[model samples]
Target: MKVLYKKILDLEIWHDYYLGQPNPPKPPPTGYDISDMLALVPTPECLRVLRNLRWLFRPQPRGASIFAHVEQASSGDFATLLPVNRPEQLTFWLIVRDRYFANFTNLPLTTNRHQIYYFSNLSLNQGHALFLTQPLPNYAANSEYHLGQLVHHDGKTLEALLYQASASKNPNANDWDILPNSQYVSELDRLPQQGLSRIYTIPKANPGDIWRLTLVNVHEQETFVLDVTTPITHTPGDAIACSLNFSGQIPGCYKLCLNNIQVDRFVLCDPIASKDAFALVEIVLNQSLVPSAFSLLQPQDGNTLIKPKTYVIRCKNRATRWRYRYEKPHGFSAASLPNFELIDAKTYATKRPLGLRLQPDSLLTDGKDQLLPAPAIALIKPETDTQAHVTTIFSDIHL
Candidate 1:
């Protein structure tokens, strides 16, 4: 199978949400897939975020690894015995589509009958499978109760009275308790709640904050700048989106930056091959994208360095230009420090005089040729000093 598109469906029962509140929260949306009687269950909410996901697992029988084929028999019943290498940890895949399945009724599961486990080779060479355990029995209007018996009621899993025997039409809060199994469902972690809109979002910014996005061509040193200001008022969950209008731009590797921080680098391919060809990029904005944090590459830390040595520092994002300052003891200072520039995508190097140490406090400029408000990041500082060798002239009398 191509496995062209796949999403994780968390096998959840109703009791997962807090029922104490006046308004109980609905269960989260789930993804689905279907073929013949074999179908993955899908909720109305999941339709918004259906996107392709890729996962790599070691060749081992995992709890959610086995794919069960639910075949509908001619007797108007769904019956199929699946041989699982690890039945105790087995999970089943249920598929339903928006157009094929309606209202989630006539589900093929027969919970009253004991689910049989068989043994054989049933490896799936098709697409991936999402496993859901055989659901428990639905709650009855009135039923004899026992301790630890599990039942499904109103989309939740509840257990019987822990230490008492009773008959209750409506399950009492004390008589029944939500079980941990109710919370066992896989979440679509990588899928964004807002769906995949080809745009960039910067998080945690106040209203009316000015953000600048610069796209610099690496080879030509050409720059394209776009500035955006956050609206004074917007919806509660709305994010500040950075514009990516690459009009009048050429095809090359472009280093991207949001404000003074280097957010990403991408290549704009030549569109001559196909008019519909385009690139989609996503980036999360937070402290994680801060460009100030970098590592000292050359002159390993705590090592003594000789004079006129070149020091290199590497950052998470490529720096177009760099700033450096050298400090010496006894008030001695270099007349001019080397103007460190991008030696590579993420590295910056400069030759400095011996007997001086680089300060840990450093900053990266927002633009290549322009000075803007840049954030301060830690720089290289080898605690050790450069050993200065002084030569004495003993032949001064000949002069």
Candidate 2:
């Protein structure tokens, strides 16, 4: 099976908002065969992000070379016995597009029927088997308890919470000002509650091991050992996972210790600050529609040469354009720090610093050459308005 598509799907899940609130579900996921999937191989940088995801385990029987996806599982599947392996994990591909958005009645899972240990070679793989679209049709009505769709922990929400939690330890940690042209800024503006959730591709977690999730916050010290159920097989290639639940917790940064080893952490931002919306600025290097490293200047004036202070976006693609912008801001105005100019072409400038919370009088797209001209097959498809959908960094700088 093509692994890259899986990575893209995982990343999409990590970045998406949880059912706590649902955005308009896009049309049914566009399915693709091997060729189409391979063509979308993101640059090495994206591969790096995919690499960062924690791999769960899936155990298969000794002769079972083939395994399949399982749709809505039954309650008694819990007692089904399977072989065991260490440091193994598994993730069920449950893609549900239902009318409820995330209103799955069976979303609140208990330790007994967690998803990690839910799959097996004996599991049916009906293509639709693993898909969880639209709350197990009103027809199957898989009992009242397991009825609703599942909900994974929202990574961005965790970041905000963790950021808030960190403030208790470091006052500088609550830096919630999203730089101009950041994804969250635009998401919030376009979709009020979007981007508040993070799309986290966690590090590899040991399969079959009872990992622990520790949340240390101002509210109360909390801890829980994760329950994993990997199939019994010495040699198998699959892992399982489920939605993490951090409900009933206060909003703040918290120390997240897993397996008592502090595998990762979570942050909860103040709800009010998170609700503020701004135009979303999708940026990429103009050179080849590839990713490039750049810096977002700090709000406070300072001599950075003494102490290098920079927010970096390291390039990880060979796409020609070193930087690219999917959407423009309200406008470009460096009045806060007048040494800047609106960029219009491909730029190789190393140091064009932007101030924090910079707002433009009007969007920069009004300028004739504000955007790089995209050819028919250009990476960027100009919006219907013919405005460049992506703004490439061609030239212009300010200090």
- What is the Å distance of residue 285 in model 1 from its true position? 34
Kindly list the per-residue Cα lDDT of model 1 for residues 1-399, writing each as its tens digit: 322212111222221111211123332234311123222222222221121112211111111121223333354432222211111111122222233221111121122121221110111111111112223456786665443355678767565533233457777885665533332121110111111112678875677778887765433244677788777885444677664666555333356777767776544432342122211111111112211121101121222111111111000111111223223221212322234432333333332111111122333232243332331222212121233211110100000
Instruction: Write down the lDDT that model 1 would get.
Output: 0.30
Each candidate structure's TM-score, on Cα atoms with residue i matched to residue i, is: 0.20, 0.21
The runs of at least 3 residues in candidate 2 whose Cα sits more than 4 Å from the true structure, single-residue gaps closed, are 1-208, 218-220, 223-225, 229-237, 269-274, 277-399
> Would you list the C-alpha lDDT of every candidate in the order shown?
0.30, 0.23
- Give the CA lDDT, 0 to 100, for residue 156 in model 2: 19
List, in order, the clash count of every candidate structure: 11, 84
Error of 2 at 319 (Å): 30
